[model samples]
Target: MTTIARVETFLVAPRWLFVRVETDDGIVGWGEATCEGRSETVRTAVEQLSELLIGRDALRIEDHWQVLTKASFYRGGPILASAVSGLDQALWDIAGKRYGAPVHQLLGGPVRDRIRVYGWVGGDEPDEVRDQIAGRVEAGLTAVKMNASGRMSPLASVAELDAVVRRVAAAREVLGEHRDVAVDFHGRFTLANARRVAPLLEPYRPLFLEEPVVPENSHLIGELVRATTTPVSTGERLYSRQEFLPVLQAGIAVAQPDLAHAGGITEVRKIAALAEVYDVQLAPHCPLGPIALAACLQVGFATPNYLIQEQSIGIHYNLGAEVLDYCVDQQPLSFVDGYVQRLTAPGLGIEIDEQAVRAADKRGHAWRSPTFRHPDGAYAEW
Candidate 1:
């Protein structure tokens, strides 16, 4: 049996975390955990979880996931689930490498030759929406996503409603009707405000309005979805299929499970199939690094109802390091026009530049998302 010899975590730049697993036979696998703004916390979680996995047979990916996920008396929150997610991905990486095939081939077979992907365009205010989208279009991207609004109040006024619609309109003008654009609500809006804003953006025809309300209130997402003519997208905060099932049944039109957060290739594929039963589109949320993106791509290629993928190439959060900065051969992971071509290489497909990862790990990061407050000093969603 190929037993896992060592498991290591690297806290890299721009708030991304990576995991490296090595077997007794000298086979290595890489995976991205990338719990943004909490890299150190997740690093500790990875180390703690590694103690449970180090001596286990590397090929028992499913059994390991069951143990890692359910062994805890209490399980399935972001930190623990995200830790299991990266380890699960690394195990799949090892399994693929051992068999000399990419992960998609190992999971039944590929349903498509290539996967379509989207880039980011960020601005707290809507003024930069048009020019930023134009830049992405000029760079050969056919799709882009932007935050739907800045810090919104529980009860938004008429001006706030118009502002959100205006941003989508600007992107729609740039993208036209044929191309695609997605709007991430970032869970910043209250239920009333989110429902009110959703219909107003329908004229612009966004591919989806993501996470209109926080996942804590996911029971209400169905009400928000039915309240809108546009498709609702969410699931970055959701950690498992149990968490996802209710939202899918809640009538979300698109499911946006992050591979790094939702138990990696193993759980996301299951989530995709569950969504297909509801006729919901699969768009794995991956605004992280290359390994996470590669894992998302493998699932995308095999998923029949996959919509489009979200990548962090040139995204605003990538301050010190970029997506391809840690890649050995960037071309294999490079976007052609808009889609990432199907990866034929064994394992996760991207050759992680170990030296770059190590050097960046040394530098590390103390990244945190900004906090917001209303005028009355009450907390506001960021």
Candidate 2:
């Protein structure tokens, strides 16, 4: 038996943690469990998980998932789920390599040869929305996503409300009729503000209004979705199928599952299956690293209702490093008119540059996501 021999983690630059798993016969697999702004915390969780994984058979992936997840009295959250998710991806990587096929092939073969992907534009909030949209358009991208606001107050004045509408209008000007633009609310809006803003942006026809309210307030999603002609999308914060079921029932037009935090390939595949029944589109939320993007591609290739993918090639969050920086063969992530070609190599397809990863780990980061505050010294969702 090819027992799991070693599990290692490299905390790479620009906020990502790469997981490398090896077997007795020298077969290696890689996965990403990056909980951006919390890489070190997830790293510690992975270290603890390694104790449970070290002597197991690398091929019994499902069994390992069942044990690593359910064996614990408390299971499912960003930390534990993110830890298991990376290992799940690595195990699937090993299985694909063992079978000499792509991960999608092992998941019942490819449903589409290539999947369309959307590029991210703007910083925490868009400063030069038109210029940024133009840049993506010039880069041969047909679709792009941008934050609706940097830090939105519970209710805003006319100036703030007008600015939000203007940002969406600016993107529409760059995209025109053929291309698409998705506006991400980032859960920065209160139900009142979201209700007011969703209607204003309808004339521009955004691909979807993402997370008008946070996942915790998901019971209110249908209110936002029903209020707008534009679609509503969510799920990067959601960790499992159960967390997603109620959201799916809320009439969301699209579902965005992050492969690294949502139970990796094992649970996300089931989540995708559930989304299909509701006629909701799939757009895996991957703003982390290469492995997460590759896993998203694997699911995107096999799933029929997949809408598009979000890759962090040059996303604003990448402070000092880019997604392709860790890829051995960067061509797999090359965009062809905004669409990533289907990966064909065994395992997760793209190779990780371990040397670069280890060197970056030497200068590890303590990345923290930005915090938001109201003028009155109260905490606000970021």
Candidate 3:
């Protein structure tokens, strides 16, 4: 049996943390557990997790997860959970490669054949949104998600509300009647604003309304769900099942747990099971690199109630970098009719271009969500 030898992390460009766990037999595995705006903090946490991994048995992933998580009394937040998530992914990669099987196969095989996916359109603007939606449709995507509004006041003006409505209206027109459109509020709206905006976007019939209210005030989610015909979706900001219980019970139409932030495969699998019990759909939130997306696809393939995937390929964040840039074999992620076919390759089913990853690591950039401000000096959400 090969024991774990070294655990190394790379702070690569576009704000990603790639971890590679190498074993005594020279077998190597890769994992990406990036917490968007806080890559450095996650990197430090992964380093701490390495202490528990070095020289330990590589196959005992579940045991290591328990120790790295519960053994430390205080646990299960973004930093700690994300750190554990990355390590869990690496272990799964190692195990799957050793056995020459995909991660989904280890998880009782795939429950479904193909996984449906979605992409982002509008950013902070109400204008140009229709054009963006049309562009996504042209790129072979059947569904698209757009930011509803950005940094509105606690009680936004009627005109501001109207602008939000108009953007949704335009997207609906571009998508016609059959295609899907989901609106993401991005936790930018206050409860009062969300209540108003939710009803307004109803006519467009969004596939879901994401984070209409801030995640902490998820109790308000039930109200938002009741107010709009659109499905209420949130959970990307949430880290664990406990954080998601109330929202799930509130009868959300979709549960969007980001695999990278929600404690990786182990924790996200738990989250998906919880969502299943509540009869809510699972759509793993993924706006990171290819590894995170591949991990999401593996989980989505095994999950029964998966709704649709949110991928970052050609997204605004990718800017200079594309999703296929890091993968050695990008065919598995190729979407036909906005769905990625089953992942048949071993581990996460996508190869990491070590040279590209390493070279990009040398030019790692400090990525920050652009600071926003209202007309007044008050800070705005990005």
Candidate 2 lDDT? 0.89
Off by over 4 Å in 2: 123-127
TM-score of 3: 0.97
RMSD for all candidates, in order, please.
Answer: 1.1, 1.3, 1.3
User: Tens digits of per-residue lDDT for model 2 on 333-369?
Assistant: 8889878889999999989888888899999888887
- Provide the TM-score for each candidate, comma-separated: 0.98, 0.98, 0.97
Q: How high is the lDDT of residue 221 in model 2? A: 87
Worst 10 residues of 2 by lDDT: 123-132
lDDT score, candidate 3, position 330: 80
- For candidate 2, report its TM-score: 0.98
Q: Tell me how many clashing residue pairs each candidate has.
A: 0, 0, 0
List ranges where model 3 is wrong by over 4 Å. 123-127
